[model samples]
Target chain A: MATLGEAKQMILDPAIRDWVLLPIMVVMLLVGVLRHHITVLITGTPKKPQLKAVRESKALMRGSQLRAFRNAIPPHAFASRKAFLTEAYDQGKYLKNPNAPKEGVPAPNPMTDPDMMEGMMEGMKKQVTNMVPQMLIMGWINFFFQGFVVIKLPFPLTLRFKSMLQSGVDTRDMDVTWVSSLSWYFLNLFGLSSVFTLILGDNNGNILYILGLHHYNEPIY
Target chain B: MARLDFEAASLELQQYRQSGERASERVAYLASRIIKDGYSAKLKDDIWPFYEQAVTAALDVGDFRLADECIENLKRRFSSSSRVQRLVGMRYEAEGKLADAQKIYDAILEEDESNILVSKRQIALLKLRGLKSEAISALVTYLDTYYSDAEAWIELCSLYLSVHAYQKAAYCLEELILLQAANPIWHLKYAEIMYTLGDYSLALKQYCRVIDLHEDHLRAMYGIQLCASKILDNGEADGTTEALKELATERILATEVNQCTIDSIKQVVREYLSVA
Candidate 1:
């Protein structure tokens, strides 16, 4: 209901008594923006941990879980013909049934069985063989290529420095004093921190040597 | 001058205490401050902070209705933020008003289908009416349009399993296996189904496969015993009862790798032989 000047005066009086005070808020906002830009530049290289190997190893373990119990629980002597014969002797009895009826016996030569043990062993070999390089590549990529795309950009300060050097500015002119005069020392510090963060910050790298990610008989690096 | 300074500091302290009293009292104080001083240019900065304080106090006291009014008033005078719509949506839903909740969730989803809160609320409403299939369909639809989520796949598979749809369950499991191929449990479950359908020979191979992968797989050991018994009976061309006894004796005398598994296998064998 009041005049616009009265409303304008009401809003500005507490925060800004005069136009001179606006510059302070503007300066703070500019600092915030510069800080944000530097952060983005440093963090642009995304490190994806070598997930494929970890996944492969987990898959192998799961496949193993699904299949068989290779090691016998009772000592072979106890469960085998030798143990039965010993037990019979200890009980003071002759062998009642030497060839007892049984179900689900493995082939006589399980190691030689083409369809069963041999094939599975081969699969295990393949899984282990494949997992190594995948892990190495992932680790190398993460360690080497952390801040990927952002570093490729024409960042303002980097551009300015390139131009300064190109214009025959002495290398000594690039010292802290000259840079400080540009009020960009803090910006550069923030930028470097961000780049390191982008390259090395992911937890996926640990998957490389983790036992569960490797093949059953494969050598892990 | 000392007296004036003392009075001003005391007035500021009193104002702080008065503002902290309650939502109604705080709102009244804010109204009085603006009404008396007219939110003039000289007081604009101070008034904005006071406005924020009053709005926050009202929301803290659960006086959301008044808070909405305050927000609307502020928006009319200033620029509105997307956060206001979010808060308004939450308040409307909290008040047990589904129509309004739906409207807000719809608006949010229209802008961002991946907004977790909007999807969550939307799913909640669909589930409340026992429309689980519809909810699942909606989730599937969302998944198709956006990200592929592993947890969602597992959830959908479990849902299908709960309903006793074995085919769908198998399909879901197969999809998961394709993504994570070495899952042992999936193989076990698939082998179990194959066993139940009387595919004994195939089941035996799976059991053997399991044992090969895991040297101590008790379940696979039990499966092996059953499959071997089936093989001993069926492999004989003459199908003689004598041949069955021969296979049975070989099994009973055979040394087991897992004693506990052998005992279980022994029991299952005895039961099957007795019935046969």
Candidate 2:
């Protein structure tokens, strides 16, 4: 149904492979290594939870364990615990602020809470660090390596991938396997996690994967 | 002007099996060295256990001064620690001041009723005071709050046994076996309890399970022999139990010659056979 010679064939320049493709990959690898160190530095030592909080959580856990393993203990023992825990929970004795009225409790204001503010600031810092270098590299690739299909993938892809694989190039008849430089950069971004892991430890890699997961779970509002 | 050698002190303490005047002298010497040298990383990490062992050793040797010093140091460092308070109670107990120890334990319980260490110490103090019923009740209360403590369960089992409450003791062993099914020791203990309760067939099954879990268990072999003969004498074993008993007998006889005391084993076999 289509013409035989409609497919466009453009010879890739040898210099683009050396200057654009390899440099982008090297820059991305370095950025990942740097990001891991920066993240570790920014997230300082964790603060210990308050003793009262610890006790409250442990009491809850104890109640659940007692309920689950009731038959493991004698009936008298189980009955006494069930009575004690029920009384405690009903009385709101172990609440963080036992005297505070339970009804009409105001929703937590994250802006007013210093701890919540600090947590938000940390999240922002992580997002900024993740985004800034990525944007810079992408812009650099688009600016310098425009209109160049940098590399051909081994496996053939469907026409649905045409827009993604040939971002800068306007040709519709080019093979889907031949990827533009921006697409190549995107591929290296997600695919070089294993290399980063080998260089850094297991915890250091998968930045793009983590960022994707974060974006996926972000609140709609 | 010699340097304090904590390693040598630890090694020397390990070598001495019996707690006597000599051992107490060694513990006192080590305690002095620890106090003079101040705390190191190792000492900071292991100070609790070291002081506990040293205090008990000092008490055994009648070196009350060293024990008192250790207790004072612990009190100063951990003023509000329930564990340290328990140790203070133990010091009072060792000094024959049972009333004072009871007071300390009561105060700790008043502060934190769920403190397992203080509860255990209080129960032990009650036992030492020869209030068996009080000890049992206290232990029951403690277990109601903290039932996951295996050591407490074992202690409760022994206390039940001491009162000739064989059924209660057997129940305790059943709980232990349920809790630690993989442990062959619990199986062996449950088997012994069953034997004492005159359930020979159940005991024999337990003994066989113990042997299956840990091959070449000498006591389990003897238990198997005793249980097999008991079952045979009563003529209560069915075909499967009879086959199992015959197999147990064959396995016991076929044990490697050097694996057991041959004479004692033969004597046990002969005794069981004659009874049958």
Candidate 1 CAPRI classification by DockQ: incorrect
Candidate 2 per-residue C-alpha lDDT over B1-276 given as tens digits, one digit per residue, 9 for 90 to 100: 788777877666555533433466667677667766874346644676677767776776777887888778778888887777777788888888999999999998787665666768888988998898889888877665555567877888999989989878877766565456567887888788889989898888889889888987878877887887788779887777667666666666667345556787777865664454
Write model 1 residue lDDT over A1-221, tens digit each, in one string. 57875654312233221322233223433433443444444332332223333333443442343233222111331244344435644553332333534448743666665546745765565444435543443454345433221111223344455432222223443322222111221133223333434544433222222334435323311
Q: Report the error of model 2 at residue A52, Å.
A: 15
> Residue A9 CA error for candidate 2 (Å)?
46
- For residues A150-205, could you state the per-residue lDDT of candidate 2 as single tens digits? 88878988998887777778887788989888777777876788898788856773
Off by over 4 Å in 1: A1-221, B1-107, B115-129, B139-147, B196-214, B224-276
TM-score of each: 0.34, 0.53
Model 1 chain B weakest lDDT span, ten residues long: B1-10
Candidate 2: fraction of native contacts reproduced: 0.00
**Predicted candidate 1 versus true structure: per-residue lDDT over B63-162, tens digit per residue:** 6655676667556665643345555665565566767867877887676544654565676666555677887787665444322345555666666666
Tell me how many residue pairs clash in candidate 1.
49
